[model samples]
Target: MPAIIYVPFGVYIVTDTVEIPVSSRVIGQAWPQIMATGSKFVDPLKPRVAVRVGLPGQVGVVKIQNMIITVKGATAGAIMMEWNIHESGQGSAGLWDTHFRVGGAAGTDLTVKDCPKLSGKVNPNCVAASLMLHLTPDSSSYFKNV
Candidate 1:
């Protein structure tokens, strides 16, 4: 069985992170975006990540398509998506037609980080500052117009 989740066309305001479980594909309408409240400053030590995927023992394909992620007023984490590291038999993931923007704050940007999977390669400067999306080791993910 295949299941797909949809985010309606419009701007949604959120203060906390949104979690998408495994084995599901999240689709957006007209490039819907999730905007974080630009008033709160995230802690540099423990920043609030925007999206998280892959729960424990989740061995099904996951996808995120057609969306724009924006963040402002963040001290650290900013607008970022995290992929949990699996032990074995990991499921595949794909990102299509997605865009990430980091601006509007004093000094903040979007970022994607997985410490367990990408430990020694990811630039510490990217993690500490700026917006970036880093792929994992041996990941068969595809991206288009992102």
Candidate 2:
């Protein structure tokens, strides 16, 4: 049977990839933020995923709603969300009201103070992430208000 994972409003920090299995629904209340930090996601050449919807070639119902996926610290290799599940049916796998915020937040050090605009200087600490979402070649999904 499919499971419904409910994430209450809060700041969830992760240093590794968080994967969601097939045939599951993740519903977040009040747009919970999933922030990625630490050295785990620092290698730009070898990008890593923070949230993976499903494994490649997995076809099933995977729904994610009302969430905020972001990156903090020097996460230049962080791919915030990766959707790898092919929908079993039309509109079966989808994301609704899910957002990705790279920086300029409370925890993320990429604020104006750290990255001063037009400073004519590059700040490595302000490098939040390399990519926001990764929809793999074998993946197909539906997005609404995301």
lDDT at residue 105 of model 2 (Cα atoms): 83
The TM-score of predicted model 2 comes to: 0.97
Give candidates' CA RMSD values in order: 9.2, 0.9
Residue 11 lDDT, candidate 2, scale 0-100 = 95
What are the lDDT scores of the predictions, listed in order? Answer: 0.58, 0.92
lDDT of 1 by residue, 1-146 (tens): 55798988876766776777766788999888766544332554555556666654455577778887765444355546655423233335667888776653332343343223456675433333133453344334556788
Model 2: residue 78 alpha-carbon error in angstroms = 0.3
Tens-digit lDDT track for model 2 on 63-127?
A: 99999999888899999998999999999999999999998887788888868899787777777
Q: Rate residue 137 of model 1 by lDDT.
A: 49
Q: Which candidate is the best by lDDT?
A: 2
The number of clashing residue pairs in each candidate reads 1, 0
